[model samples]
Target: MLQQSARDFLNRQAPVKHLRSLRDAGGSKGFSREVWAEMSALGWPAMAIPEEYDGLGFGFTGMGIVLQETGRTLTPCPLLSSAMMAAAAIVHAGDDAQKSTLLPGIASGEALVTLAFDEHTHHRPGQVAATAKRTAGGFCISGHKRFVLDGAMSDQLIVSARTDDRVPDGRGISLFIVPATASGITITPCQVLDTHVLADITLDDVRLPAAALLGAENEGLAILEYALDAGRIGQSAELLGVALEAFERSIAYLKERKQFGVPIGSFQALQHRAAVLFGELELCKSLVLNALHRLDSDANEIAATASMTKAKVVETASKATAEAIQWHGGIGMTDDFDIGFFYKRARILETMLGDRYFHLDRFARQHGY
Candidate 1:
């Protein structure tokens, strides 16, 4: 089903050109509402939600499969930012009433929600300093968040704020559902390496009702961590797809490009490079699939596995994109070539969520090293 979905999208959207057009059109959502409605009609956004919430109940594994396909084409969809990651936040921590009210629209893709967690230059979850002080009717949020995916386009923002005196430990952190059109909100558009649009959001005395809070007060770190773990697995799957696409393109170029009246692939050095890339791709695939399975089965070492998977996928995908460019030689360096597009996207994905350094450190700490 996943592969078919990808094939269907490619057939309809014309692959990389479709994404290029989205960028050219100055898309705020990085996607069209019509396409989003089509995806919703296909029941894709609901794949991660539980069956009780009118979802397919396929869990993270299903989400991983869909993301892999999206990554292959570099589809400008919010499945990762809104559906998989932010929806996980709601599904895992939201109260029954909250779940019933919020998730149905999310599942149907009628509502687009995004996470606003990073408040600083780094991707540290524990560095949340955005204050949510008690007010008359509810609370007032005040601070800034950078690199919020789909922040400007999403209908609802799942914001993380400091709710207590705890600092750098994530204990005082809390998540809230704030309207994107709220009075004190400002969204500044920012572009990343891949030409993907991110929003820098500033909350200046943004007031919300008491019922806007999701999960328990001053105890949101655990919920955030749960959602992050699921996101890491989805990211790994997407990176795996990226690596595979780049590697396949490189192999094709090698077979087609000729030197000395022979295909470049006939050369021993080029053949060796292809073999190494193939091995790494296989290893990445194994790790990604294993992590997805571990999460699906509720494994005890989920944190460690997730970190390991994320770090490996970043390394492998980076290497694959670099090799693809190198093998393509001069043509790959030009803007006309699609390989450059993949390379830029790989570079952006490298530091998204967390970089190699961050995940490696997290892996070490998870193992008590």
Candidate 2:
């Protein structure tokens, strides 16, 4: 199966043990060139690209399968930002020149990129803080983008800014693929609770050529929605992997672990809890697979399925991870234990696309009353 191949590929390249090293180096904790190169060489950074572009061209399901393995190992790479999000945008809306310039760089793993969607201090993609003024050169962008994932590390940035402030919300926002090396751009690292440091970017009259504008001017929020929908599903796949891994770990512990001269797996209470976690994992798995399948066919329903998958996967991962820790006892909490790593990875993935509560509300909204 595709999942098996993906898992085998990761194991052969960077096993679960390497994940601990990455955690020590870049598993939501640090950044390392060693780990990044290893991942890039494995074709993970271009898993979703078309074969004509030198990518695997396996579609969302294949990409999702690879992401699940990445989540299971917690290997550090720009798989999500560069491959899933930025590449998706270029594939969908970039002109021929843009694709020739950016896609090949992405395919070869020579560049890193991330899209900045939210600029609001609150929760809204439409309310962007960044503004772009039309310049003789092209456009001059001025404003700050907060909480951009990998903003500091990206060689190129895909920014959302207002070209028409009077139009309001989604209508005015636009996307710019600005080189990080460009003058007048500043990135300050902001440490997050998850141990990773996201960048807060300041674009101070950052000038760009007209070619920098992706698609049409004053029409970015629509593309942002498309890009976000794609990213959310892949995130859900990773989330599902962690939940399943943790659930399976808990089950294994219950089977082998003994208490009062009997295997804990035989206990009624533990059995019930294990069954519940199994049901949760299976539910998330179904939803994620369903979402992946719809990505190539039904663009209209993608948002709802993506939200639903994210919600279900996040909840399953949280409950499963906690239960794995508890079931494994004190040893599980120790750094020497493997279950602890899985638990930590699961917790991190739960917050990838959005929080559990955020997705739950989104799922509800998308499905109507």
Identify the leading candidate in terms of lDDT: 1
Clashing pairs in 1: none
TM-score of candidate 2 against the unseen true structure: 0.92
lDDT of 1 by residue, 139-233 (tens): 89998999988777788999999999745585998999899999999999887766677899999999999999989999888888878888888
Over the stretch 1-369, how does candidate 2's per-residue lDDT look in tens digits?
A: 767876886777766677666556553534556667866776777777788777778777778888887777655567777888898888888998888888878877888878876665544677787888888889998888887777778899999898997886669889998999899998888755434557788889999999999988888888887788888888888777777776776788898999999999999988998988888788888888888889877866687787778877887888888888899889888988888777676666666557677777877887786
Question: Which candidate number has the best TM-score?
Answer: 1
Total clashing residue pairs per candidate?
0, 1
Q: What overall lDDT goes with each candidate model? A: 0.85, 0.79
Q: After the best TM-score superposition of candidate 1, give how far the Cα of residue 280 lies from its true spot, in angstroms.
A: 1.0
Local lDDT at 50 for model 2: 81
RMSD of each: 1.5, 2.3
